[model samples]
Structures are given as structure tokens and as C-alpha cells.
Target: MPNYSEKPTIIFDMDGTLLDLAYDDFIWNELLPIRYAEQHQCSLEQSKQTLFSFYQQHNHTLKWYSSRFWTSQVGVDVLAMQIEQKAKVAKREGCIELLTYLKENGYPIWLATNADYAGLQFKLEETGLRDFFDVIVSSETLGHAKEFIEFWQILASKHPFDAKNCYFIDDTEKVLNGAKLFGIEQLYSIQQPSSAKAPRETCNYPMLSALTDLIPILEAQTTEQAEEQKKYA
Candidate 1:
């Protein structure tokens, strides 16, 4: 069972959580490397290694801001071009419906992601899902990934939802652990097709294989809340 004392504000993660982001894997692993190799006169394997090394070394750096990775590696304006390219390759699944249901029922849905704005915008536009969120927050805006407990505190100060009455759903176990550390009442680790096994400390809360599974519970909760509000009125 989901462990919330009452209906709480829902925070969602984008990318591989609410949206299937296999497109990114394909781009990074295949398309980007091939393009770089073709443009730079290097072996495809060497091109892949170069880009992977940069990402591995600077995964959290704001180097993405300058689009240097694209310039230095692929010799093209990847930030702009990747928008349409990723859309062509991306796919939406059941989670899209769940997000729509949550919005229709008036849940205060906030999106928390570690993605850069351009990347986040691409995914949302590709999936035609920009309107599902009340606000889409990137850790870039927060100045850190959600893995930092401090980032959650900053979010609480700005958003002011109850920690004991909040539902944080994310596919990354590292971010989930950060939520748990900050005393979020319910932490859910989603199982996307691309996600790996639950990392350590995942036993602290429930596991959901798909966002669709939460639809019934949320619908019931919404109905109950409406009925209670009517009675009080």
C-alpha cells in the first residue's frame, strides 16, 4: 500500500520517470557518436568514448549551458537540432494517461527534474506533454540535483508542501534516497523499461512499475476529497 496519512501534493520526475526517455539512450549511445565520427574523421568507437568520457567526468557540470559538448564533439548545434530529432525517436506510454488523470482531478502536480531547460523542453514537446504540470522545476534552477537533501529544503521553502503529506515519485534511486532523507512521507521508485534494479535504501518505500497503477488510488482519493469538501461546505 502507498504510505501517506492523507492526500498529499504529488511531485513527479520527468525523463525516464513519467516519460520514456529511451530516445536519449539512443542519441547518446548511437546517433551522436556516429555523427561525431563522420564529422570529425574519427572512428565511431573513439568518438563514443570521447563523449562518454566528458559526460562521465562532468555529468553535473553546467558545461551543458554553453552547448560545448555539442560544439567540441559533434561540430553542430545539437541543442537546437536534437529537439526534432529526439521527438522523431521518442515514444509515450501509459504514464501519460496517469498524468492527465492527475491534472483533471485538480491535484497540485509539480515536476522535479535534473534535466537542463532545453532538454526538459524537448522531452515535453516531443511527448506533447508540456501542459500536465503546474510547474516544471529543473535542478538546474534549484542549483543542484535532487540527490542533495538541501535542494529538497529549498523546494519546500518555495513550494511549501507538507513533508509528511507529499508523494515524490522518481525512477532514480539516488533522488529517492534524498527525498527519504529529507523526511518525505512517501517515496516511490518507478520501474521504467530503461531503469535498473532498485538501489540501496529503496526498501524504505513502495515500488511502482508504472504510473498507471496509481490512477485508481488517486481517483478514489479525489472523489473522497470532493465529497468531504461538499459536506463541510
Candidate 2:
């Protein structure tokens, strides 16, 4: 396949990268299963175990829990109400600057998240970041988590972006590995103090302490490529 160099695509993982939902410390650990337990009349411990098992065993399965499941399990219309209330409280720092820099540089930004469509859309909208991205790719759209390399492959096939010049920013090591396997040339791992304890398969990649740290590297690469192209021409 011929490489197109007109524009570089920078893909972002929504939850930990752009908005901080504090899933590990709060939602999964507290809010979610507790809510389910309360509504289902089960013990909190049981709900927690069930939630973990569901995600672990059905990582790629769409049947794990959609809004409907949560509704039935929690006896409330979770889909009708915004689920990102917690996200609003926990969104990470430096996201605005990162999005602005990328937007200014003409990078076609996109989001690939494991969030269900409604939840994903709600978070972006709640954060007021909906307009910054060209597209939002969800695992729900692919019937699997981004942990699988094929999810990214399918996304790339559908969106048809430049992999050689493409970049992926994510907090999950598995998703980063998947991006590498999918042929993304540039990748960044967000490092946040609150997220330091999250489980990662390997911490071998370059760690970014802040989102703004990416600007110089990407700008320098763009400049270097432009100079090299001019010399060739």
C-alpha cells in the first residue's frame, strides 16, 4: 500500500487519556458494582466479583453489559441519564492544551475507546470535547475490546488513515501493544500520578508525564519530514 503523507492521524484512547473517569479507583471499585448491588439486592462484594468476572470472561463479548443490562441490574435507566457525572469530577489535567495543539497543527484526531456508544458519547460531550475529534471509534462498534489487535485493524480499514504517520495515545499497555501490532508509527503512554497503580502488562514504552510534552516531539518530526521531502523534491 502506498503511504499518504498529506495529514497525520493521531488516535486517542478516551478514558484515561483525554478524560479521567477514575475507573480503577472509583467506578469499578465503588460506584458501579455498589449501584448494581443496591438495585439487585445483592451484597456489594458479590456485585464486585460479578462485575470483574463479567469483564474478565467476556472482555470481547457485547453481552457483558450494555445500558439495558445495567438498567435491569440496577433498576434504573442508566442509559437515559448521563453516566459521566463521575468523569466530570475526575478528568485529568492538560487535555485541553493537547487537543488545541493537535487541532492547530491540522492533525486529524480520532478516539478509540472501549466505552459503549452512549457512555462514550456522553463523556466526550460532558467534557465539551466532542468537536475536537474527527471520529470516535468504540469497541462496541467492533464487538470487542481494543485489547485485540484486530479491532484496530478493522478500525483502520474502515477509517483508512495513514498508519506510517499515525500515532496512538493511551493509558492501557495492552491497547498500546495492539496499536504497535496494527502498524502505528508513533505512540505515547500517558503518565498520571492517580493512574500509576493501574495494571500494565509492560511499561517499556516512552512515558509522557503530561499531554503537552507531545507537542515538541510531533512538531519536530513534522518539520524534519517536511525538510526531507523538500530536499527530495
Candidate 3:
């Protein structure tokens, strides 16, 4: 395992980028509503209405990604529920293939996820994605969601990296916009984040249909860099 630290750093989002968003979709969208109804002794419809309203109110905010925050607001231990369904957690298509390629080739890998620390911990533990990353951060730890430039600011402070020389891949458009604002040179989004959902038709940044789709992009960058070096020589 020779790691080429000089290569352009690659930052990834956890749930929706490297890992299947289907597990999260099942946890939040399908399972939580039923559990909320059971806990509150209400109809499933009522539970969904209440929860969906909360989602709309806080979507893309730091609170939106916190299991503890939801637990306190909804009277459900959301973290525990997610842990219970850890069996549903899975890696997205080509996730391991792409990561293995990067790791073997020496690209420094980092994970910047909006998932709270608890969620990040469990998912990484279950998926064994922790070892692949040199850096792992949770928005709950940063005090700002990835949708804000401040999050990138704080992250850069803690771990110095060249934003202009790095690539970031995430499923969320707002997160990509934040990284772009912070001067990240290359940003990408997933075409289909969740296995249970349809592929996204468009994104502001280039969309990766499969995780391995990034291989040729990186290879081409290396090729161009070599050609420039030869020209200078």
C-alpha cells in the first residue's frame, strides 16, 4: 500500500456518494414514520405529515442531518433505530472499485459528510469505509452543514489542504455549491444516489453515473500533467 500523497486529494460524501443512499432512505423515509406512529399512538399518515413538515422546515440545515436532533424533536431515538437497521446499509455501485483504485494509486482520500457523528460512526463501522479515508468529518463536529462555506473554512483550518487542487464528490447539489464557493477545483454529483430512487436528470456539477466513472477523469488529469511536465522539460 503505497499511498501517493502528492496526488490531488479526493473528498467524498458518505451516505449518498460512496455508500448507497437507499439505507438512509429506508431509515428516514420508510421506517421512521412507522416507528413514530407507533410511539405516538397515531396513524402512519399523521406521523408522516408531522415528520415531513419537519423535514421541509429544516432541510439542508445542520439540524436536518442529526439523528439526535430528530430524536429530541420527534420523541424517537432515531440513532438507535438506524443502528437496528444496519443490515440494510450498503456500498453504492462501484464504490469499492473506485476507492481501491484511488487507494492503490496513492490518491489521498477524505470523507466530508453531513451525517451526524453517530450516524457517520455506525455507517462507516458497518460498511468498513473508515480505513479508506485519511480524513473523516461530520457536520455535527464542524458546527456547520456542508451547505455552507463556513464548513469548508473550518475543515481547512483543522486539516490543511489545497482546495484549488482537490476534487469533491457528493450527492447533494447545495453541498457542491458550498465547496465551489470555497474554491474546490473539481466537484461532482451522483446521478443516482439511492438505489430505490430514479437517477437525477441533471446537476450543476458533472454527474458520476457510477463511482468508477471517475477513474478515466483522474487518469486524464495525470496524462495532461505529464504532458505539461514534458513540454517544460
Q: Give the Cα error of residue 71 in candidate 2, in Å.
A: 4.5
What is the lDDT of every predicted structure here?
0.71, 0.73, 0.92
Model 1 TM: 0.78
Give the per-residue lDDT of model 2 (tens digit) for 1-233.
23235667888888777766465346556677767788779998898898787668754445543666656655656665446444433556788898988898788989888878877766766678888999888888887678777888788778888788788888877778878888886888877625536534446678777778888888788788777777667
The best-first sequence of candidates by lDDT reads: 3, 2, 1
lDDT of 1 by residue, 114-218 (tens): 877767776777677778777778777777678878889988888788887678888777778888889986777765535332323444457676678877766
- Ranking 1 against 3 by lDDT, winner: 3
Against the hidden reference, what TM-scores do the models get? Answer: 0.78, 0.82, 0.96
Poorest lDDT segment (10 consecutive residues) of candidate 2? 81-90
Q: State how far residue 119 of model 1 sits from its true place (Å).
A: 1.9
Instruction: Kindly report which residue pairs in candidate 2 clash with one another.
Output: none
Measured by TM-score, the strongest candidate is: 3
Off by over 4 Å in 3: 1-5
Please report how far candidate 3 places residue 127 from its true position, in Å.
0.6
Q: Per-residue lDDT for 218 in model 2?
A: 85
